[model samples]
Target chain A: MASDDSVSLRVTPLFSLCQELGARFTPFAGYRMALSFPAGTLREHQHTREAASLFDVSHMGQIVVSGPDRVALLESLTPASIRALPPGRLRYSMFTTPTGGVLDDLMIACRGDDLMVVVNAARREADLAHLREAARGHAADVALLEDQALLALQGPAAAAVLSALAAGVGDLPFLGMGPFALDGVLCWVSRSGYTGEDGFEISVKATHVEPLARRLLADPRVAPAGLAARDTLRLEAGLCLNGADLTPSITPVEAGLGWVVGRERRLDGQFPGSDVLFQQLAEGPAWCRVGLRLAGRAVARPGAPVLDPQGAEVGVVTSGGFSPTLNQPIAMARVPAALASPGQPLAVRVRDHQLDALVTALPFVPARTVGRACSGPSEPRNKP
Target chain B: MSKVYYTEDHEWIRVEDGKEGTVGITDFAQAQMGDVVFVELPPVGTVLTQGEQAAVVESVKAASELYAPVSGTVVAVNPDLPDAPGTVNEDPQGEGWFFRLALTQPNELADLMDQDAYEVFVAEAGESAG
Candidate 1:
C-alpha cells in the first residue's frame, strides 16, 4: 500500500484478519496497525514470553540494493563491513552521518547477488532518500520492495510453530536468511527477531501474508501480538529503538554499539565518521549508554532526567518502561562514562519527585535467542 | 448506595458520607490505559484542589495523571497499590479506590456529571479519540 498521512492510512494485507480477531487499531508510521488484540497488551506480552506470538511488521521499509558495486555502495553509507558479510547471514548496522550520529539502525542481509535492508518505518522516507543519494554517488540501483509483507513470529516456541508450517525453517541458524516456501508460496525467512527470543521474520508477497498468518495462528501455541507488546519486549531485551535510543547526535560508540563496527574498517578508516569514531574508540565517549534498574515501581519514561546522588543532572533516559518479564521498572540512559558502572546510584526525575535508581547492565531479562550465547559481559542475576 | 459523579478527565468520585468521599478512575479510563503496573497516591493529609493533579497511574506503555475531582483533603489511600497495582485494573470502582478525601466544598459535586451524563461524555470522548 502507498504511504501518505493526509490521505487514508496504509493497511497491511493482514488488516482484515487482525480486525476479525478483535484487534485495536492505531495510526503508526502512516499505517493503521494493530496496537493489541482483545487479549490486551499484558496478556499478549506474557503469552509471547511464555509461548509464541506473531507480529505484523509490514510497515517497515524493505529495500534491495543490487549492481556490480553493490557492496561498495552499501559500505559507504554504514559503518558495518558489508563487503565481508557472508551470504545468507544478517548484520545489524546503522546509517551514520558524517558527524558519527545515527541516521537509522537497520538489518542487512547478504544474498550473494543483492543485499536486502530492513529499516525502521518512522525513518523510512529519510532512509530511502539517503539510499538514493548513496546510489547516485556510487552508480548503484536501490529499489524499495513495497509489495512484501514482513511478519515476525517470536518466542521460545516460535521455531517449532514455524517448522510445522514450513520445512527446513527449523534448521536455520540465528541471523540466517534464505528462500523458503510456505504452502507453495515463495517467501524469505530469517532466523532473527527483535524480541531477543528465538524466532523468525518471514517476508512474503502481500497477497500471501493473510493465509500464512492464519495458518500459523491455527496452532495453539501462537497468538497475535501487536505493537504494544513488541515495544516492551524489545525494551526488556535491551534493544534500541531507532529514534529513541539512537538519535542524530548519538554515535555508535556512545550507544554501546561498538561491536557492530568491523575491526578491519576501524584500522583502515574508510567509512563515514571513521576518524571521529576512531577517536571515540581510543578515548571513550563523554557519555555512555547504560541500563538503569529503578528502585520503586514508578516508571521512568523517556525524557526523564537522570541525576547523580548529589542532585546533579548527569544524563537523560533514552528508553524507559515497565518490564513485564522483570516485574519492575527498567530504563536505558546515556550518562557520563565515569558513572556508568553497575551498582552506581542515580536518581530519575519522573514527574515531580526524584526516584532512586541504580546503574545496571542491560537486557533487564536475559535473552534467549537460539544458537547464540549471551554476548555481553556476564552479570549477577536480579541485583535490583 | 453512594452517588457517583464523574469529571471530564474520567475520574469518578463516590460520596460515602456528607463530608467524605472516595476517588478513582472509571472502568473506561483503566481499559483505555491497558495494563496498570503502578499507582502513585497522594499522602494522607495532603490538601487537593478541584481539577488539580492528585495521583499518578502508570501502565505498561504510559503514565497518566489522576486529577482531583473535588476540593478536599486526602484522608486515606489504598495501601494495596504499591505491592499489587493490578487491583485498579481488576476492580477499579471497588478495591481500586485511590484515596479518601474529606470534602472542603461539598457543593462542588454539582459541577460533575451523573452516571448517565458521564456515559454520554465517555462515548463522545471515545469518538473523538477514535
Candidate 2:
C-alpha cells in the first residue's frame, strides 16, 4: 500500500470540512477518504437525487500545460480535439499507449492560455510522465497543481448551492469554467462532475478548502458524501473507473469511447497508437465492452467468469455491484462480440454456482434530463 | 427460569429449556452498523464450537462475523431476516433474534459476561472500533 511509503497522499483543504460534516473516513489511492456518514450509503445516494452532496476529490491529479503551442502539443496526445476547444470549455479525452490502449481518461479544460487537465488519482504519476515526455521541448511547460485542492458539489441543487455561496457562479453552464471568490477565497469553478448530475468542481488553494466547503455545505440540501456512495453513484450512472473499465490493454473503441476520438486526428495520424485505433475502427474488435444484468439474486463481482449456455467461459466481469438505484446486481464485462448483443442470455460464474445473467445495452440507466441541462443518473431495470 | 449473557464480540445468548439457548447480536452492534441489510445464519443442524462465527451480519459498508458466546449446535434460524433485515436493528434482542442452539456443554456459560458488565464494556468500546 502507498501508506507504507514515507510520503503520504495529500489531503485537500476540505478535509476539516468533511470531518465537521460527519464523513466516515477510509483509505483510497493513498489518500484518507470518507466512506459514508451516519445517514449511510442509501440515504447519501438519495440525498443526491432529492438535494445535493459535496465530495472531497482532492486526490485527483490536476496539471497545467502552459507556454506557446500547449494546445497543439496536448492535441497531439489525446483523442479529443483539444486545439478546437473554446476557451473556458472542458472536454473528456483519453491518453493512448503506443499499442493504442487507453492510458487514462481525463477531463481537459482550455483556459484562455493554459490547458488544465484533471485525471484519476491512481494514474497521476504515469499520466504526468506520459504528458511530460510528449510535451518535452515542444514549447510547453507541464506544471502539476499540487498546492490546489479539488472539491465536487453535485446533484439537483448544485447550481443553487453555488449561487448561494458565490456571485456569478449561477451563470456558468455545464462544462463551463470561470474564476470567482467562494466564501472570500479565490478559486476556479467549473460546472462539471462525474456522477451524472448537475454539479460544480472547485479548485482552491489548500488552506481555504475547509472554510469554503463548510460555507457551501451549510445549505440544508447539502450533505457530506464518501467514496462508497461515490462509487455506487458513478456505477449507477454507467461511468467507468479508469483501471477497472479501461487500461492500456483496451483501446478507446473497445471501451465504447470512440466518440472522444477526433476525426481530424484520425486522418492526420499524429498520436501514438493511431494505426491500431484506425484498424480497430475499420474492423470491429473481436471483444467489446457491454453491460451485464444478472438474472438471479446473486451478484457477479469483478473477475467473475462469464459463460455461454454450454458453460464455456467467454468473458470476464471488470466491475459489478448491487446498484442502490436499480436495486439489483449490475456489471460491465468484456465478452465475445457475438455474446455482446442486448437481451443475449449469459451466465456469471460466482464461486461454484452459475447465476443467470443477460447482456444489456451499455449505460443501462438511460440518461435523463433533469433541471439545468444536467444528465440525471441512469437506472438499469432489474431482472430478479 | 434462565439468564441472558453477552460477549465483547457483540453477540447475546439467553439460556432456554436446559442446554438450549437463543443467540443474536446486541442493540449496540446494530446501531454501530447503521442499517442491517443482510444476515447469513448457520444451518439448523450445523455444530459450532465456542468463539466460532455463528452468523454473518452485512450492512452497506461490509460484512462482519458474528461469534458465538457459547458452544452449541444450531437449532433454528430467523426466517424473517432475509427480507426484513431492519428487524435486527429495530429489535436485536426480540423479533430480530438470529437462532436457537442446543448447547454442547453447559459449562461454557462461565466465560460470558452478564448484562451489567456488558453494559460498561459497550460504553467504553466506542463506535465500530471492531
> What local distance difference test score does each model get?
0.87, 0.78
Clashing pairs in 2: A365-A378, A365-A379
lDDT of 2 by residue, A1-26 (tens): 01123146445566666666677566
Give me the displacement of residue A206 in model 1, in angstroms: 1.3
Model 2, B18-67: lDDT tens digits are 68999999988886665566677788998999999777776655557798
Best by DockQ: 1
Q: lDDT for model 2, please.
A: 0.78
Candidate 1 lDDT, tens digit per residue, A229-261? 999998888888888899989988888887767
Candidate 1 regions exceeding 4 Å error are A1-8, A373-384
All candidates: interface RMSD: 7.4, 6.8
